[model samples]
Target: MIGVIATMTVQDGNGPQFEAVAAELIEKVRAQEDGNLLYQLTRSKADANVYKFMELYRDADALRAHGTSDYFRESFGKLGALLAGEPQIEYLDGV
Candidate 1:
């Protein structure tokens, strides 16, 4: 299994829009990606504008498929304008 963690900070006044878009993207990814084991969006308790995405995939191919999907591309395009800066992403391997 593969795990991915992505962190993003929303631009001022963009939290609601970001959350709405992310929710829809999450739903699409969960429903359409056969190798997606888990997909979750979470907000920081200390800062409402800080968000984290937790994802689990069956393997590297699954991860690649998720990144290349049309739905993901579309959603990311929208999400780009709402972000404060570049997102931070980390990849992990299951033990």
Candidate 2:
């Protein structure tokens, strides 16, 4: 499986807003993108604004398709101003 682990830190007090948008993005992907196996958003207990996304896709094309999806493009673009720093993405191969 093609996967990605994204680490992000949101601006203070923006965690809830970011979570809401993330939830919407997940729903969109599930409903519209068949190649996406999973898209999950998580938060660190120690830091409320620290977030993570665990995603699983069929392959590179599926991963790239998600990036080009309208929901992702729009939501991710809007999230830039509310983020504390650049998101760190780690691509991986499942065993």
lDDT of 2 by residue, 1-95 (tens): 89899999999899888888888888999998888998888899998888989999999889989999878999898777679999999999977
The deviation in Å at residue 9 for candidate 2 is: 0.2
TM-score of decoy 2: 0.94
Output the number of the TM-score-best candidate.
1
Off by over 4 Å in 1: none
Q: What TM-score would candidate 1 get against the native? A: 0.96
Q: Give the CA lDDT, 0 to 100, for residue 16 in model 2.
A: 81
Q: What TM-score do all the candidates reach, one by one? A: 0.96, 0.94
lDDT of 1 by residue, 1-95 (tens): 99999999999999999999999999999899999999999999999989999999999999999999999999999998899999999999977
